[model samples]
Target: MTVRTGDELPPLRIPITRTLIVAGALASRDYQDVHHDAEAAKEKGSPDIFMNILTTNGLVGRYITDHFGPRARLRKVAIRLGAPNYPGDEMVLTGQVTAVAEGTVEVAVTGRNGIGHHVTGKVTAELPTDGPGTGDAPGTGDAPGTGDAPGTGDGPGTGDARKRTTDSPATTDAPMTTPDTPR
Candidate 1:
C-alpha cells in the first residue's frame, strides 16, 4: 500500500434502501423514528425515513477500510451530512489521499447521492509501513480465520447494512511522500 497525496480511491456505490436505513438504525441501537418509521419521518416534515448519522459513519469507515485493507485503523473521521438519503437513491463514495506520513494517511472523502452531497469528511488512518501484502506476515496476529474470527468474508458487508458494489480499477498509486518526510 504505497499511498501518496492526490491518489484517488475507487468509488463504492451504496444503495439506500429502506431495509438498510432501518437495519442500520436498529443495529446501532438508534431508535430514532426518523431513521426507521416513514410515517414518523413524514410527521417530522421529512419526505421519508432517512439514514442516521451513525449508519453513514459506519459506511464511511467501511469505505476507507475496504480500500485500505482490513489492517487499516481509522484514527479520526470528521464528517457532516448534507442530503438526506432516501430509500430509492444511492450514494457513491469517493476519496482522494491528501497526506501520507510514516505510517499514516489522510483522505478527503465525499458521498454523493441524487440530492447532492450526502456526506463529506476527512479520515485519518494508520497503515502498516511494511507495505502491501504484509498484513498477514508473521507476528502480525491478524491473519484471517485465526481464533473465532468468523471465517473469511465474502467481500464487504454481510448480514448487516446493504451489500455495496465497488467499481474500482487497480487504483493504488505510487508513493510520492517519503516516510518521516514533510509533505
Candidate 2:
C-alpha cells in the first residue's frame, strides 16, 4: 500500500542525469556553469558536470512523497553529495523506512552514481491514514494535501542544501578526481 504522511516507506530509487542536473540548477537559480558547461566543468576539475546536492535531495523526496500523491507532507530532508555524475553514469537514489511519528515518517536515503554516491540523507514527511482524519498536519500550516508547509517545514525546511557532487571525478578518464569504483 502507498505510505501516507507519517508512514514509513519500504524504499525508493531514482536515476540521475545531465538533464536532471541542468534542470535542477536552472530551477534553483544556481547558475554555475560548472554544473552545465563541460569545458568549465573540466576546468573546475570535473567530467561533464553534475547535479547540485540540493536538487538531489529534493528529487529524492519527490521520488518517495510523489508515490503517495498530494497527501504526503515533507517534514525534513538532509543529504551529502559524493561523486560527480557524468552523462553516462546512472545514479541510483534509494532509501528505507527509518521511523514514523506524529503524522510524520522518516526515511534514511542515499543516491550513488555509477562511480559512487552523490547523496546520502534523511527525510521526514506527513502521511495521512485512510481513516477519518482532521487532514491537518502538525507543522503544515495550510493543511494536509496542500503544497503549503507550516512551522518546521515553512521555515528553514523549504529548500534543500547543495554542493558539487565531488571535489574530483571518480571514474576512468574522470579528467579531474580519482576513481571510486566499488571495491
Candidate 3:
C-alpha cells in the first residue's frame, strides 16, 4: 500500500499483567530483578515489578511492522520510557507516519499506560513500494519455495557449503586450538 506523511496507524491495546511483564522480560533476555520480582522492585523504589526496556522496544517494533505489513524492515527504533508498566495496567500504542521517502517510512509512536506515557519514540522502516499484499518483498513471509528442506539452496540458504572455505591458519593436519585450549 502507498503510505504518505501524516498517516495514522491503527492503535493497539495491550493489557499489562504479571505474566506479560515477566514473559516479555524473559523473551527479551532481560533478567533484571526489577522486571520480575515485585518485592525486589519495591526495594529498588518502584511500586512493583515493571516491564523492561527491551520488551518495550519489541512492542514498538511489532506495532510498526504490523502496520506496515511483513515487507517492512525496521531500520531504527529509538524509545524512551516514562511511567512504569506495572501489572494490572494497560498500554495503548499509537503511531503516525512522520515522513515517507523512496522506500522508507518514518514513524512517531507513543505507548501510554494508566499512569502516563510508557514509551515514546520514532521508528524508521523500509516498505515495499510495489504496494502491500503483493507478497514479493524479501521478508514478506510469502516467498515461494520457502517450505523446502532446511539446507536446500532453493530456499534461503547459501547454494552449497562446499564452495566456501574458512581463512583459519590451522590446516587439516593440525588440531583446532581455541583461546580456551592450549596448543
Candidate 4:
C-alpha cells in the first residue's frame, strides 16, 4: 500500500512471556540479569524480569519496516522507554505517518503494555521510489534534465523493470536447521 501522511499503520499485538523476554534479550546481546532472571529482577525492585532497551528498539524497528515493506530502509529511530514490559503482559504497537517527503517517510510510533506506554519513538525511513506501492511513476519524481523515464531502462527510476522469480532452490528445500534444533 502506498503510504501517506496521517496514515495509520496496522497494529501489532505481541504477548509478553518469560521465553519472549529472555529470547529478545539474548537476541539483542543484552545479558542484564533483570531481563532474564526474575529473582534478580525482584532484587532490583522490579516485580519480575523486564525487557531490555535493545529489544524495545528492535521491536520498534520491526514495526516500522513491517509496515513499509522490505524496500524501506530505516534512516533513524529514536525511542524512549516508559513503563516496563513484564512477562504475561501484551504489547500493542501502533504508528502513524507524520510526513511523506520525496523519498522518505517519517513515522511516530508507540508500543504500549497494560500498564502504560512501553516505548515511544519516531522513525525516518527511506523508501524505494520505483518499487511497487510507492506511487511514484518513472520520470515523475526525477530531477529535470535527467532523461529518466519508465520503460526506457535509462536510470534507476523504472518500476517493474526487472524480472522477479520465486523458483529458487531454497524455496524447494527443507528449512535450514538452527543451533536450537536437536540433531
Compare the candidates by TM-score and give the number of the best one. 1
Model 1: how far is 177 from its true place, Å?
9.3
Clashing pairs in 3: 1-131, 1-132
* Candidate 1 lDDT tens digits, 1-183: 457889899999999999999999999999999998889999999999999999999999999888876666666789999999999999999999987765677899999999999999988776655433334233445455543145345322343113322222133345733222344
TM-scores across all candidates? 0.75, 0.64, 0.73, 0.71
**Poorest stretch of ten by lDDT in candidate 3:** 169-178
Ranking by TM-score: 1, 3, 4, 2
- Candidate 2 local lDDT, 1-183, one digit each (tens): 333223344445455677878888898889999878889998887767877766776788776665534455565666777787667677766666655444445667777777877778877665554443223324333344443344444333445312212222222211111111122
Tens-place lDDT digits, model 3, residues 1-183 = 556678789899999999989999999888999999989999989999999988889889889867766545666788999998999999999999776655566789999989999999888775544432334234644354444335556222554323332222121222212122322
Alpha-carbon runs more than 4 Å astray in model 2: 1-15, 130-183
Pick the winner on lDDT between candidates 2 and 4.
4
lDDT of 4: 0.72
Kindly list the per-residue Cα lDDT of model 4 for residues 46-154, writing each as its tens digit: 9999989888888888887676654455667889999999999999999997777655677899999999999998887766655233322333333433333334553
Candidate 3 lands at a TM-score of: 0.73
Best model number under lDDT? 1
Lowest-lDDT window of 10 residues in candidate 4? 165-174
Query: Backbone clashes per model, in order?
Result: 1, 13, 2, 0
